[model samples]
Target: MKIFNAEKIKELDKLTIEKQQITSLDLMERAALQAFLWLVNHFQDKKTVYHIFCGDGNNGGDGLVIARLLKQNYFDVHVYIVPFNENFSIVFNSNLGRLKECNLEYEVISEATEFPNIGENHIIIDAIFGIGLTRELAGWIQKLIQKINYHQSFKVSIDVPSGLFLDKKTTIAIHSDVVLTFQFPKLAFYLPDNENFIAEIVLLPIDLDVKSIESIPSTYYYTDLNKIKKRYKPISKFSHKGTQGHALLIGGCFGKIGAMVLASQAALRSGCGLATVFVPKCGYEIMQTATPEAMVITDENYHKITNIEFNFQPKAIGIGMGIGQDDETTQAFHHFLKTIPFRW
Candidate 1:
């Protein structure tokens, strides 16, 4: 999966509209239909009501389409238009006009209007804002977000939360139970700081142009099993122990020698021809018993590692696991780094 920013997503949508020779309204319908189908499959009972909170942007257009489809399917639905911006997108107005044909009613919420009363049985669909939002939310919009968070209803966000900044840190954002995103997963969705705002994510493809997506440059990427599998190489049947690479792991103190044992075992299991551990004298027996396959070299110090020296060359060396920051240990580590020819 490739992670894209808000601007790239907008560009993809434009390219999709141009290359597919379809109207933006049609694309909006496609996205909404996908979301609607997911909802139907997830909630088989169809007895619960969906209270959709929409903004006056393209995201709101998607919500309007969803609400119309749900109404046509005989499910109870309510649409609340959040009047935060005076200007509306062209597709938004088009969708709003189409709502009249479905015989479904919608309410326009303002600062003075009373918030809708929701219950535990109802679900809240948040389309208040999308990836395009770049500024801090204030005024009635902020208040509305607070009210929505206060409610006990299960919250679902479309694309992203109303106040979140897709490319940077956000001061306020909607805490959704699930996020239904289009095309690709946004970078912010994977960040730990925004985990509360974006709980679980479901990626839905809206049939964007593949050529355009491949051509677009991105700094972030999501790796799956298939991508990782492609990097594996076939080992030659005639290969011997000398042909494989060797790995050395340096770490462990008096009581933390288990860390070195674990690292050495992992290196050996990873197909390395040989694994070696450099630890204090106290860790000699522990490493040997834990990992009999790995070779060990003990330092002169009895309790902690005070020197790092090896005769044979290793393909890779991994350092700093359970190595305490004592004065002698720190000095020894610095001396080792200075003595070795540093290379990644």
Candidate 2:
């Protein structure tokens, strides 16, 4: 799965609409239908109520379509439109008109209106904001998200969490139990900093243009099992220890030799034919005693590493686990860097 930024995703949507010769309304309906099907499959209990919060943009259009589909399927549905702005998208107006035709219950939230009562029995569908958001949420919008999070209901976000930004650090965001994103996963969803805002993500395919996805350039990507399996090579039956590659693990002060010991052990476990560890003179007996399978080398300094010397070159080098920034150790690191052919 490829991770796309906000602009690239918007471009994908535009190119999809143009190349597929489909109206934006039809595309919104497709995304809404996919979300509805997913909800139906996951929420088997028919008695549960669904409270959908929509905005005045295309994301809100998605919520309106979902509400209509849920009503057709005989599910209890409640729709609320967050009146964040006076202007509304054409597709959103079309969906709102279609929703009103069915006589389903719906309301528009304003300054004078009270927030809806939500409980744990109700599932909250958030469509307030999507990836196009470029500013921080304020006023009642922030309070509304806080209220939604306070309800402790099972929340699902449409396309993205209501207030989360795709490219920057998120300050205020909706706490969702799951996110149903269209097309590709957003870059913010994969970052560790946004883990609290993003939960289990479901990539909802809206049938966007494949050529657009392939043609778009991105610096990030999502890896899967198939991609990882393709990178490994099977070992031959006639292979020998010397034929396999060797690995050198370098790092360790007098009191922190355990770091080097663990690194050498990991190198051996990772199928490196030969594993060697370099430490200070004080750690010589410790490394040799703890790991007899690994070859041990010690620097001339007793308490800290001053230099690294070896008769033969290893296939790969691992450094800087427990190496402290002592003056001697720093010079030794510089010397090692200058001696190695590979760039760090």
Candidate 3:
């Protein structure tokens, strides 16, 4: 689940192609097939009209392959090629030729005016740009994306959304309903700055070389259920309450005793053998009433925490929940930190 940058993803693709001895076209076909399969699974109705917007790159090539597959399967598919410039990838041209061979007609959109009028019932597949997009889009292309966004159609972006940068924040990009990304999750998808443009991300694995993926260095990772399962350790049958870890939660003032109650309860639910809460004197009765399982200790002050005192060593300490930034509370917290023993 390592989240790699655009360059690292390209490197992984190159390594995968070299290790598997497959042509780039073969890889493109595999990626397109995965996307096609996803479409088939989600949109089973053959009457569903698909408006696939493709660029003059490999992402467009994937769109072309998907168009051909959908057409062959008797689906209502319409393909439109957005030629932003004269340059085009070889695989893209190859897929375009394959689409022509299937007698499936497609239109080339050169201007913003040439953009199609999409209905709300249609599914818009955006393959106009992928992870390779670095710079901001041109005015006309941005307008095209804006028009796509204006439609109330269910939009699914291929690979990454058009105009979205994997490594940096993007201002203008396709605001997709669902982004069907390949292999690893892009870093931009998880960032708060790009929250408006991103949507439900579905990872589609293309069988990239596993060793090559592991060899690449990445600082970010997307932890899934499989990863958690791998790291999960079952509890020993002979383990008792004392053998399990102890957790200490310290926070809460007069009116904010609920915070400590919830925290202590959460600690116990997380499988901690012992749950203890250190709060102001005013929170002692509330914590005991709300969370009967947790042991509570109260500071000398009633409205706020003036001191944090505990005898037994806790495996983990979680502090500062509802503790207001009062001068006395701040000084007490500082003194507590200074006096606390670090077992590790």
Best by lDDT: 3
Question: lDDT for every model?
Answer: 0.88, 0.88, 0.89
Which residue pairs show backbone clashes in model 1? none
lDDT (10s digit) by residue, model 3, range 182-214 = 898988898898887877999999999999988
Model 2 TM: 0.91
Residue 334 C-alpha lDDT in model 2: 94
TM-score of each: 0.84, 0.91, 0.89
Ranking 1 against 3 by TM-score, winner: 3
Cα-based lDDT at residue 321, candidate 2: 70
Off by over 4 Å in 3: 235-240, 326-344
- lDDT of candidate 2 over 177-279, digit per residue (tens): 9999998878888788898998799989999999888998888888877777898887889987676788888889978988888888888888888988888
Instruction: Pick the TM-score winner.
Output: 2
